[model samples]
Target chain A: MPSSCDEKIPRIEHHQNNSDVSITICGYWSLNSRERLRLLRRWESLVLQWKDVLRFEIKCDESLVWDSSLVVFLRNANRDLSVNGGQVVFLDLPAGLNKLLNLADEGQKRNKEQKQDPPSDGFLSMEALLKPLDFLGALVISFLNLVRGRSVMRWRDFFASARNCSASALPIVTLISFLTGVTMAFVGSVQLEKFNATIYVADLVSLAMVREMGALMVAIIMAGRTGAAFAAELGNMNLNEEIDSLETFGICSVSFLVLPRTLALFVMTPLLTIYADIVGILGGLLVGTLVMGFSALHYLEQTQSALTDMWEVYSGVSKSLFFGLIIGFVGCYKGVFSGRDSASLGKSVTSAVVISVTLIIIADAFFETAFSLLELR
Target chain B: MNVSGRDDIVIRVESLDLAYGNHLVLKNISFEVRRGDCLVVMGGSGCGKSTLLKSMVGLLAPLRGKIIIDRDELWLNGDKKRKETLKKLGVLFQNGALWSSMTVFENVAMPLEIFTDLGVKEVENLVDYKLALVGLAGAGNFYPSELSGGMRKRAGLARAMAMDPEILFLDEPSAGLDPITSKRLDDLINELKESLGISFVVVTHELASIFDIADDSIFLDSESKEILAHGNPKDLLKENTLTKVRSFLERKTVNNS
Candidate 1:
C-alpha cells in the first residue's frame, strides 16, 4: 500500500449535495488515493449544496477537473469534463494515445519548469500561516492547566528551573542592573551636589532596588530565559504529538507536564529577585565609592537611615512570586499550544518569550500601582 | 450474527452520525463487534472509516447516535461519562502515537498506573510480559524516537495491552510497511486476539491484512455517508452490488479518471 503522502498529486476534487455545490482545486501532490478520496469527501461536507451556482476546480496531474461547471477552454478540445450533479470533472486525455502521451510530456516539462524556480514573489511558510489568535488560545489553555494543581506547592522543580532560569541569566542581569545603579548614582550625585545632598544617593539606590527594580529585572530575565525554554520544549512536544500521545494514554497533560514547570517557576522567582537586589545595590555602592567620592561606610549608613519600613524588601519578594507565576503560566501555555511542526515550535518559542516579558512588565506596573495606593512610600 | 445470548458484543454502535462543523462525515452508521472477535472497519479514504473507529473508542463524539461498550452507554451525554467509557478501550493509532519522551516501559506502564491500582512491581512485571508478548522483550528502556516504525507499532500495541481492556481499537495498523512486515503484524494481531480474547476494531484499507485477520468487516460509502455493507469479507466481495467494492476486491486499481 502506498503511503498517503506518496499518492498525492495536484488535482481538483468536487462534491455536490442538493442545491449547494463546491469544487476545490488543490495540489495534493504526494498524497495517496485514500487521502485524495478523503479530501474529496471532506470538501463535499464543507460545500453542503447551499447554492446551485457553486462550482469548484481540482487540479490533477496534467489537467484540471471542474465539477458541475461548464468549461470553455481558451484553445483545444482536449479539456476537462464536469461530472453530473456538480460532483467532479475528469480532464480527459485527447482521443489519440500518442497525442495524449505527447501532451502529458509537455505538461510534465511545464511542471518541472515551475518547480525549479517557483514563483517566489510571496509565499508564507507553513509556520507563518498559523493564526496568532489560534496560537494564543492554545497557549491560554496550556498556561491555565500549569498553574492549577497540588504540585504548585512543590519547591523542587521550581528551584531546579530557577537555577536554570536565574543562574544562566545572572551575567546579563548583573551587567544591566549594575549599569543602571551606576548611572543612577552618577546622575543623582551630579544633580544634588550643588545643595550638598550627595548622601541621598544611598536612599535612591535602596528605594529602587527594594521597591521596584529588583523583582522587575529578575522577571524580565526569566521571561527571556526560562519562559522561552518552556515554549520551545512544549512546541517541540506539540509538533511531535507528545501531548496527543498523552491524551490517548489517558494521562492528564496539565498535571503530568505543565504542573512541574509551573511549580518550579513559582518558587524560584523570589530567590532570583533577591540575587538581583544584592547585585544592584552593590553596583550603586561601587559607583558611590569610586566615582562619586563617597566612602563605602557613609553610603551604607545613609541607606539604613533613609529606610523606615520593612515592606520595601518584603514587597519586592511578594512581587517576584506573582511575576514568577505569570512567567510560568505564559511559558507553559505557549509551549502546550504551539503548532505541530518545527517551524511552529520556533514561532511558539518566540511568541512565548515576547508575551511573557510583556506580561511581566504589565504585572510589575500593576503591583507598583497597588503598592502606591497603600501609601507604602 | 446472533443478536442474543453470548456475554459478548463488547461494542454496539447504532445509528451513528458525525460531522465536523458544517460537514456531515458519517450518516446513520451502525455496527457491532463481538467480544474476542477481530473486526476490520475498512473503507476508502475520507469515508468516515477512521472516524467511526474513533467513535467506538469514544475519541470523537458523534452528532447523533448511541455506542454501548460492555453495557456502558455513550452518546449525547456529558464528557465525564464519555471519558470513563474511554478508559475501558485500548487504542493503537495510525502513527503508533507513542510518547517520544518516555521509555517503552513507561509508555506501557502508563495505563496500568492511571486505570489500575497495581503497584510498581506488579506493573513492571506486567509491562515486561506485554512487551514480550509483542516480541519486544528487551526494548523497554528505549525511547519512542529511537525505535523504527515497526518497532513503534509493536510498542504501541504493548502499551495498548497494558490495561488489559476488553476492546482494542487500531487505526491503519498495516498502513506503512512492506508486504512481509505487514504480514508479520497481521500474524501477531491474530495471535493476540486468540490468546487474550479481546475484541478488536481496526481501521484500514490494506487489502491483504483485511483478508488475513478480520473476522467481520464494515464498508462505509463516502458518497452516501452510510453503511454500505457488513459481514465476512469473502461473502461481501462475492455479493457486492457496488462497482467500487467489486473493483476494490478485484484489485483492478482505479485511476484518476
Candidate 2:
C-alpha cells in the first residue's frame, strides 16, 4: 500500500507488506532550513504512525541530492523507531553519504556516552563546598611565598598594575563619587527644607561621603572596570596556555600574576578613596551653593565641622582597602581557574564583577555593624 | 601584468617583504599558486610562515610586494575591490577560531549570510551541505566549546568552505592532533582539492601531512628571514636544497625510523 505525504520536495511514500514497513523518500529531498524544520515535524508524526511496525526500511531515490539536513532527519527517525522496538535500515544511498551517516552515528554515540555521566550538583557535592577553602589555602600560600621574597612577584608588574588601578581609574572614580555626593545632598536637602534645616544638608552629605558612600561607590566602579579587565586579561592568558608555560618555567603563576595586581589595588584603593572623599565633599558644596541657595562659606564651614572627626574618613578609607583586595582576589581567582575557551573568559569576567560587588557589600555591612557596636558611628 | 594566457595562476607574490613594527619577519619572498594546487608552507617556529599566509589572505599588509590574486592586484586595489577579491579566498586560523557564542551551524552560516543574498532557508541548506562535506553532519547544534580539538578543526574548515571559495588557506591544520586524525585531515584536504579543484595554501611543519597533501611547497627560514627553498616536497627531499630544509625533513624521517 502506498500513502503519499504533503511534503512536495521531500515527499515520503509509506508502504506496508504484512508485518514489514518501507518508507521511500522521493523527489528533490534537498531542503533549506525552514523546510527542514517542517519536514522533521512531518516525519515525527509519520514515526508515530509506524510505532507498531517491527521492521522498517528507508529508501532514498537516486535523484536525491541532500546534505546534513537529510542526516538529521534520518537520525531522528531511526531514534524514534528504535524507541518503539522497531529496526530501521537505510538503502540506495551513495557511498559518501553512507560514510557521512556512519560518522554522524559515531559522533552521536560519543555525545551520548558523555551525557550519560552528568556532573554532580554544585549544592550537593562536597568538592564544590570545599572549593572556596582550597582557593583560600592557595592564596595564603602564595602570599607567604611573596612575604618570604621567594615568589616571582616582579616589580615591573606591580608598577604596571598600580598605574592601571590608580591613574587609569581616576576619571571614573571622580565622576561616580561626585555624582553620588550630589545625589545624597539633593535628597537630604528636600527633607531638610520642610523643617527649614536645608543648611544641615551639608552635614548629611559630608558624613555619608566620608563614612560610606565614597568608598562604596569607588569599590563598585572598580569591580566593574578594573576587576573585569583583570579577569579578561588573565583568562585570555590562561586560554593561550601562557599560564602553563609559566609553570613549565618553574614560575609561580599566582605569585607572578595575582600578587602584583592585588598589592597594587591594595595600595591604590585607599589613596583613591581619600581623593574620592574630597571630590564628593566638593560636589556637595556645589549643590549647596548652586541648588540649595546656601552660601559657599556656610556649606564649607558645615562640612568641615561635620568631618572634624577623622575617624569617619579613616573608616571609609580602611574599608576601601579590603574592598580592593576582594576585587583583585575574586578577579584573579575566576580568571586563573577559567576554562580554556572564549566563552569561559567572558563568564569569568562577568562573575568577577558580580562576586566582587557582592562581597564588597557584605564586607561593608560587617564594617558598619562593627563600627556601630564600637560607637564609631 | 599580462593576463592573456595565464588563466590557471590563482595567486602570485613578487618580492614580498613583511615586517612587524620595524622587525623584518620575511623578506624577498616570491611564490605562485596555480589553480587546484596544494602548496605547503613549511618553516620552524617563529619563521614567518603564518605571517606570509596572513599577508596573502589580506589580513596583514606587506611592507613591499605585489600580491596578485585571480589576475587582480590585491594590495593595489581599493577597499571595495579588495573585499571582492577576498571573497574568492578563505582562511582557517590555527586555533579553529570558531566563535564561542554561536553553534557550529551559525558559525558556518555567518559567511553565507554576510556575502550572499540567499534567503534564510537557502543559507541553512548550504550550511548543512558544507558541514556534511567536512564530516560534521550531525554536530551542527553543538557549540565550539563542546567539540574536541579535531572536531573543532573540522568545524572551522566547514566554516571556511561555506562560501565555496576557490582558494583555501589553512594554518597548521594538523597541529596538536593525533597521527590518525592528522592523516584524516590530510585526506580530507586532498579530496576537496581533487573534487572541487580548489587551490590550497597550507602552513604546517608536519612532515607526514606535507608529503601526503602538498603538490608544491615553500620553506621560510627564520634566521635568514627569507624563503630558503620552493618546490615539490618529494623532489625537495631528494634534491640538494637548502641545508635547513634538508635537515628539517631528514630529522623527522630519522626520528620516525
Candidate 3:
C-alpha cells in the first residue's frame, strides 16, 4: 500500500512509568489507518503485553475524521484488552460514532428479545418428527370442516389442477409407456426366439405392463410433474401473503388452497394410470404383431390367456389410489411449509418430487410383499 | 381541481383524462397541488381516487393531456428524463407492500443503497433515523410478516421517506388499522408534514384521517366522474352547498353518539 511507514497516521505507543497506563493514538486516522500493517502488528503485541493493564485512557488527535471502521477497531481492541470482566467505557469521541455503537447495541438487544432460532433439521429432533404429524392433523381438521360445510374450498382449483395433471400430462406418459413396452417386447423376443417360443413375448409384455409397470410409471410421472407444480404454486402464494389474507378472512388456507390441489391429484392419478395401462398394452401388441410377424388377433388371444382374470389389473389400479394420496399429501406438505424465499421455494419443489417418488417406490414394494403374503398372486 | 397558477405549485395536471379500456374514469381533470401541501384525494368507494393518484405518479399514462411534476412532464419527457423526474416521488401502496423477504432495515435502506453511494455507516444511520421517525426504532430486524398491521404501515412509511422525495403518495394508509392506530398514523403524517415540509398526496376515504391531516383536498364523484369539490375540507364541510359534498363530509356512523 502506502509507499512507506513514515506516514505515522496510526502509531500505537505503549506508555510506561505512569500513574495510569494509557494507550495513545495520534495523527489522522481512518480506513487508511488500516493500511499500516506494521502498526497493526505493534498494536496486537502491545495488547498482548498490556492484558493485565485493564484500566487505560484513550487519547485522540484534534484533527481526525473517522467512521465505523474506527469504532470497529476500538471495539475489537476493547474486546482483546478487557477479557476478564473489565469495562471498556467509551467516553466522548464524537456524538455520531457513539450513537452508531449504541444503535448496534440496541440491535443486539432486540435480537435477544426475539429468541426465534431456527430449529435443527436433524432427523431425531422432536420438532422435526412432530411437524408432519401437526400438518396432517390440521389438514384432517380442515377436510372435516369442508365436509361439514363450515369452510371455503376452491373447487375451481380442483378442476383446474385435475385438468392440468391428467390431460396435459398424457403426451409424456404415453411416450414413456410406449417405449417401455417396446423395449420389454423386443428383449423378451430375443430370449424366446432361441427356444422357438417367440409367441410368449406377448404374454411377457402384457403381464409386466398391467401388474408392475403401469402404476409405477404413472406415479413417478405425476410426482415429478403435478407434485412439483403443486409445491411451486403454493410456495409462491405463501411468499406473496395470499395465504395470509385468506387466514385473516377467517378461512383456513389448508381448506381453501391445499385441499383443492391435493384432491385434484387424488382424483386424477388413477385415471391417468388406467389410460397409461391401455396405451402400454397397445405398444406391446404393435411390437408383437409387426416385429414378430404374428397376427394381431393371435397376440390379443395370448394376452387374454396370460391374464385370465381382472385380479392383476385390479391390484395395480388399487396401488395407484394410495400412490395418488402419497403424491398429493407430500406435495402440499412441502409447499405449505416452504421457507420464505425464492431459493427455498425451488428446494421445496425439488424435495416434493424427490420425497414423493421415494415414498411411491417404497409403498409399491410393500404392496408387492403384502400381495405375496396373502397369496393373491 | 385547478384554481391558481402560482409558481409554488409543484404538481399540475392539465386537462388530464384517465381511462381503463373503454370506460373513462376521469375526464378533463385539471389540478394543482402546491408545494408543502397535504392534498387528500377523497371520495366514495370506486370513485377513481386511486386512478387519479396513479396517473399523477407516472404509473398510468394519461389517456390525454399532460401531468407536470416540478416542471417535468411525466408522459411527454423521454425515458431518461422521466426517470429523473420520477425520483422526486415516493409512493405507498394500499397495503404496506413491503418486500416479504427483507428485514425492515433492508427494506428501508433499499432506496438509499440503490440510488445513492452513501457508506454503510450513513445508510445505517439514515435507516435507523427514518425508522425512529415512524416510531419503529427497535423494529429494524423484523420481517414484514412478523410485524403487526400498524407496524407494517409505519415500516412502509419509513421506506417511503428513504430517498427524501419531494412528494409522498400514500394510498389508503389507514386501510387496515384499528381506530387508535389509524389516528396515531394520522398524527405521524401531520408531524412529518410540519417537520420535513414535503408535499403529500394521500388517496383515502377515511373521514378521521382527512380532518386530521389534509391542508387541502379534492372530492371525486363517481357519477359525474370529476372532482366536484376542492379547498380546505373543514371549510368545504361548513360552506359548500353541494349535497354530494355535504352528505359525504357530515355522514355519521351509527356506533358514534
Candidate 1, superposed: residue stretches over 4 Å from native: A1-196, A305-308, A341-343, B1-6, B75-77, B255-257
State candidate 2's TM-score: 0.55
- Model 2 pairs in collision: none
Model 1: DockQ score: 0.19
Q: Compared to the true structure, candidate 1 yields what TM-score?
A: 0.73
Every candidate's CA RMSD: 13.0, 19.7, 20.5
Model 3, stretches more than 4 Å misplaced?
A1-11, A18-22, A26-38, A52-55, A62-67, A84-154, A186-196, A239-241, A247-255, A282-301, A337-351, B1-257
Put down candidate 3 lDDT per residue, A184-205, tens digits, no spaces.
9999999999999999998898
lDDT of 3 by residue, B34-135 (tens): 888899999888789988977776667789999998889988976556667777887776667676656999878866765678999999999999999999
TM-score of chain B of each: 0.93, 0.94, 0.94
- Poorest 10 consecutive residues of model 2 chain A by lDDT? A112-121
Considering only N, C-alpha and C atoms within 3 Å, which residue pairs clash in candidate 3? none
Q: For model 1, what share of native contacts is present?
A: 0.22
What are the per-model DockQ values? 0.19, 0.02, 0.02
Q: What value does DockQ give for candidate 3? A: 0.02
A40: Cα error in model 3, Å: 2.9
